[model samples]
Target chain A: MPDDQLSRVFAALADPTRRDIVGRLAVGDATVGQLAAPYDVTVQAVSKHLRVLEDAGLVSRTRDAQRRPCHLEAEVFDLMTKWIERYQRQAEERYQRLDAVLARLQDDEQQQTDPDEGAAS
Target chain B: MPDDQLSRVFAALADPTRRDIVGRLAVGDATVGQLAAPYDVTVQAVSKHLRVLEDAGLVSRTRDAQRRPCHLEAEVFDLMTKWIERYQRQAEERYQRLDAVLARLQDDEQQQTDPDEGAAS
Candidate 1:
């Protein structure tokens, strides 16, 4: 898939099934068959979902006999968390600035307080 | 085009250009031409990208003469936040349970403890 890491991660998680698989893997590592047992989908389909999760770096697999047990990599959660926090903070900051601007405008209409628009109150 | 909301949102954000546009919109409402100015891409392509964001409910445009200043609907961020937090929380909960299981296993192997796999001590 032609995607950035963020895209890969978001697209990987866009599926409810893949999110569930990640959920199960987080509790403990499990073989593909074990992961597939709860879902009605074929093993191959679940395998594909795991592949997407793997590509997103959300999950990793190790061999044990013929089974490939998948494990969740918690570190990748930080990537999404950081991205979300950054934008959320920015949006909130913008909202606060807008509020200040509106207050200043109201003050100007009243001709009451001489607030410096550029100053951070 | 034939995509679920989650898919549409992801595909809309798959482009870095679109993400930048969204970031700028989060800061303040801007017209299509203003959004398109920073990039080398044609305004038509940027308009197409805005259409994607609009369909995803990330951006909303309203009439201002011939201009449609795009506003970021902050509620949409909650949609993504909810999705991300659900998976992230589930993953963290799973990790805690796994830690308990592993500790139980280690204890079983250690002091000749009767570690019932089904029972929690």
Candidate 2:
């Protein structure tokens, strides 16, 4: 996915209400009314949240005029997953390297201490 | 881990510049001056981005007053990874279930058509 689209996806999910809406939609598609039922917010408010999700390509609405249920677009998650995993893996590897260096230093210290202990004994 | 922190993390990465900074930091820690070098933006601007990242716990600055290199906290990625993976898995399972239903319908249609072929033969 393009950087702009990725930015939109991240921005969309940044809101807790939108994230909750997405969590519910993952279970199954739901009309805006059904989605807004649990929240104290107005349907209009929920609709605005859906607009953000739709713009981010994280959710889609069916053509049915009467009851256009919101469907979660699972594929977009792959884009985010790929981006996040790449950096996550890189960071983890760096940490692992740091850990190795620290371990080697500790081993050297132990070796030095072992010889000192022998001399003292 | 907490919803607020997750929100901050998502919001922090929403900007392309911030994400790029993060990608670079994952490879190794860098001072704000180093991070600002690649972009046309000022060092102060890069510092602002780092502030957002620090608030989100995605990046941290060292105590050194002269050169506080930013470090990528890989653990925060775990929080985002878990959130995304949960919803991604849910949506995928839902798709799998829908596919199963469609497959069953196709099987029934084939069975119905087979009897007609037998009668015609």
Candidate 3:
């Protein structure tokens, strides 16, 4: 996905209601009425959230007029998963490198403090 | 992290500049001036981005007088990773169940079409 679409996906999921909607959709497809029934919000409000999700490619509504069920597009989650894992892995590797450096420094300090012991060994 | 903080984190990363800052910080910590050097925007703008990141617990700025470098707090990524993976797993399982149901239906259809073959076998 392009950076713009990724931004849109993040922005779309930033809302608690929208995230809840996505969670519900993950279990099964639901119409706007079904989705809005749990929340006190109006159907229009829920529709707006669905619109954002649709725009972000996270959700898609079936064209059936009577029952326009919103389906969770699971593939879009891969885009976010990939982006987040990239940075997370990089940060982890950096920490591992730092740990190795610290360990080396401690070894050097130990050798300096017991030079005679090191030579005997 | 709470839902509010997760929202904040998602909102913080919605901007391309903020995501870029995060990607840079993943490599190593950098002062606001250093982070803003590559962008056309002013240091103040970058500081604002960092503020959002800090609010979300994704980045922390050291209190050093010479350079308040921003460090990436990698733990917060776990919250998002967990959230995304939960829904992704649910959706995947749902698809798998649907595929199984379809496969059963296909087997049933095949058995009906070749009733004599099944009896012989």
Worst 10 residues of 1 chain B by lDDT: B111-120
User: Model 1's lDDT to the true fold?
Assistant: 0.81
lDDT of 1 by residue, A1-121 (tens): 5577876886777676887787677667899999999999999999999999999899999999999989888778778667766777888889999999999899786664444533536
Cα error of candidate 2 at position B84, Å: 0.8
Candidate 2 lDDT by residue in tens digits, B52-92: 99999999899678988889988898899899999999999
Report how far off residue B88 is in candidate 2 (Å): 1.1
**Candidate of highest TM-score:** 3
Candidate 3: tens digits of C-alpha lDDT, residues A53-107: 9999999998777878999999998989899999999999999999999999999
Candidate 1 clashing pairs? none
In terms of lDDT, model 2 sits at 0.92
Error of 3 at B53 (Å): 0.4
TM-score per model over all chains: 0.81, 0.83, 0.86
**Per-residue lDDT value at A75 in model 3:** 97
Q: Candidate 3 local accuracy as lDDT?
A: 0.92
- Please tell me which model should have the higher lDDT, number 1 or number 2: 2
TM-score of 1: 0.81
